[model samples]
Target: MSSTWMTTRAWLLMLPLLAIMIAVIGWPMADTVRLSFTDAKLVGLGGRFVGFDNYVKMLTSGNFQRALYATTWFAVVSVTAEMVIGVLAALLLNQRFYGRAVLRALLILPWALPTVVNATLWRLIYNPEYGALNAALTQIGLLDSYRSWLGEPGTAMTALILADCWKNFPLVALIALAALQAVPRDITSAALVDGAGPFARFRFVVLPYLAGPLMVALVLRTIEAFKVFDIIWVMTRGGPANSTRTLSILVYQEAFSFQRAGSGASLALVVTLIVTVLAVGYGLLVRRAAGSAA
Candidate 1:
C-alpha cells in the first residue's frame, strides 16, 4: 500500500512536466508540419497554397544535396573519433593517479567552454599567416610556407571535425569514466588472475559493461552533430566554396541570406525528419541492447 501510494504521488508530481512537454514541444512540431504545406514568407504575407512543391524543390536542389552530404560525413566521422578517444580517455581516468581529480576537472574545460569561444580559438589556431598551427608546423619543418587550414576546400571539413571532436569527446570521456568506475572489481581481478591479457579482459568484461552508456552518448552526439551550426558558422561560415556547408548551414543561407523562406523552411523540416529518424533508430537500438544485456 505504501509503495502504491508513493507511485501515485510520483505520477501526480510528473503531470505538470508532461503538460509542459506537450505545450512546448508537441504543439510546435504540429505547427511546423502545417507550415511546410503552405507558401510562407520571411517578412511578407502568405504567398499561395503550395502542397509539397517546396519539399520537391528542396530535394532536387544541388545545394541541399551538398549540405546533406556534408552533414552526413561530419556526423559519422566526428562521432566515431569522439567515441574512440573518449573510451581511451575514460580508461586512463579510471585508473589511480597522483592528481586524478584535478586532471578530470581540467579535462572538462573543452566541453564546458562556450561553443562560440571554442570556434574563435580554433579559427585563430587555423589562421594561415600568424596562427599558432601554421607557426608550429613551420617550426617543425613540415611546411616551408604558411597555409590556411580553413581556407582550403579539401581540409575545411576535416578541420571542423577535429575541432568538434575536441570539444565533445570530453563529455563522452566523463560519462564513460563514471560507468567504468561502476564496474565490479572482483570480476576484473578474476580475469587478470586467470592470465587474461589486458586487451582480452577489456574485450570481454569492460566493454560489455560500458556498451549501454557508450550507445547513449553516441546517439546524443550524433543528433547534436547532425544539427551543428554555431561552431561552423563562427569558424568558417561554410565558406571556401561551400565545402563545409551542412544542412543547418544551408537553412541559414536560404532563409536569412537568400530570403527564400518557404524553400528554406521546407529544407529545414527535411533535416528535422532525418534527425527524428536517427533519434528513433537510436531509441530502438538502445532498447534492444538493454534487453539483451538484461
Candidate 2:
C-alpha cells in the first residue's frame, strides 16, 4: 500500500509538466497537421478536408521552386562563410594578446544586437543614396555611381550573406572558441617544437581537436541559417523580382498575405521535415566525429 501511494505521488508530480507539453507543443502540432489537410483561412470558421490539394498546388508552383533554390543557396553560402570566418576569429582570440579581453567582448556585440535591428542597419548601409557605404566608396573612387545593393538581383543575396555573417559569425566564434579552449596546449607546443609551421600546426594538431565541435557548430548554424526569415524580411522582404524569396517567406506570403492558412501550414510542415532531416544527419555526423576524435 505504501509503494502504491509513492507511485501515485510520482504520477501526480508528472501531471503538470505533461499537461503543459500537451497544451504548448502537442496541441499546436496537431492543429497544424489538421489544418494542412483542410481549406482553412484566417477568417474561416470551418474548413473542408481537401486531402493533399494544398501540397500538390504548392509543389506545382514555379515560385515555390525558386524559393526553395534561394533558401538552399542562402543556407549553404552564409553558413559556410560564417564557419570559416568564425573559426579563424576563434583561433585568433584564443591567442593571448593586449586588449584581447576587450576585443572578445566587442566580438559579441553584433550577435547580441537584435536581428531586426541588424537587418535594418544593413538595409541602410546598402541604400543607394546618402548611405555610409556609398559615400565611402565614392570618396575612394571605387564606384562611378551609387548602386542599390539590395535592389540588384546579383548582389541582393550576397549583401544579405555579408550582413548575416557579421551578425552570426560571432556566435560561431564563441562556440569554436570554447571548443578551442578544451584543446591541449601541450600538443600544439609539441608540434611547434617539432618544427611544424603555423599552417602545419593548425592542420595537424588544432584541427583534430576542433573536428567534433566544428561539426556541431556547422550543423547548428546550418539548421538556423536554413530557416532564416526575419533578417531577409526586414531588409529585402524577398524583393524586387522575388530573387531573394525563400521557403520561409513563401509560408508567410501564403498564410498571412494570401489568406491561405492550409497552404501555409503545409509549407511550415515541409520546413519542419527538412529541418528534422538535417538534425538527424547532424546527430549521426556528431557521433561519428566524436567517436573518431576520441
Candidate 3:
C-alpha cells in the first residue's frame, strides 16, 4: 500500500510536465501529421483529406529535390568543418598557457551571439561595397575588386557554411575540451615517456577520450545545420537562384509564403525523418565505438 502511494505521488509530481509536453509538442505534432494528409492552407479551418497528395507532390518536385540536396550539403560541410576546426581549437586551448581562461571566454563570443545578429554581421561582412572582407582582400592584393560574396550562386552556400562554422564551432570545441579534461593524465604521460609524438599521442591517447563527446556534438550540430534557417534567411534568403534554399527555408516558403500548409507539413516531416535517420546512424556508430573501446 505504501509503495502504491509513492508511485501515485511520483506520477502526480510528473503530471504538470506531462501536461505541458502534451500541450506543446504532442498536440502540435499530431495536428501537423493530420494536416499533412489534407489540402490545408495557412489561414483555413476545413480542408479535404487528400491522402499522400502533399508527399507525392513534394517527392515529384524538382525544387524540393534541390532543397533536400542543398540542406544535406550544408549540414555535411558545416558540421564537418566545425568538427575539424573545433577539435583543433579544443586541443590548442587544452594546453597549459597564460591567459587561457581569457582566451577561452573570448572564443565563445562568436557562438554566444544571437543567430540573427551573427547572420546580419556576416551579411555585412560579405557585402560587395565597403565590406571588411572585400577591403581586407583588396588591401592584401588578393582581389582587384570587391566581390558580391553572397550575391553569387557559386559563393552563397559556401559563404553561409563559413559563417555558420564560425558561430557553431566553439560549441563543439567546448564539448571536446571538457572531454579532454576528463582523460587520464597518467596514460598520456606514459605515452609521452615512450617518445610518442604529439600527433601520435593525440591519435592514440587523447582521441579515445574525445570520441564519445565528439559524436554527440556531431549529432547535435548536424541536426542544427540540417534545419538551418535564420542565418540563411537573413544572409541570402536562399537566393542567388535558389542555390542556398534549404529544406527549412523551402518548408517556410511553401507554408507561409505560398500558403500550402499541407505540403509544408509534409516536407517538414520529411526533413525530420532524414535528421532522425542521420541521428540513428550516429548513435549506432557511437555504440560501436564504445563497444570497441571496451
Instruction: Tell me the spans in candidate 3 whose CA falls farther than 4 Å from its real position.
Output: none
Q: Which 10 residues in a row give candidate 3 its minimum summed lDDT?
A: 285-294
**Candidate-wise lDDT, in order:** 0.91, 0.92, 0.93
Question: For model 1, where is the 10-residue window of minimal lDDT?
Answer: 31-40
The sequence of per-residue lDDT tens digits that candidate 2 reaches over residues 38-70 is 999967686899999989998899988899999
- Over 71-116, each residue of candidate 1 has an lDDT whose tens digit, in order, gives 9999999999999999999999888989999999998999999999
Q: Considering lDDT, which of the candidate structures 1 and 2 is the better prediction for this target?
A: 2
Write down the TM-score for model 1. Answer: 0.91
Give candidate 2 regions above 4 Å deviation. Answer: 1-8
Task: Give me the overall lDDT of model 3.
Answer: 0.93
**lDDT by residue for model 3 over 244-286, one digit each (tens)?**
9999999999989999889889999998898899889988988
Model 2 pairs in collision = none
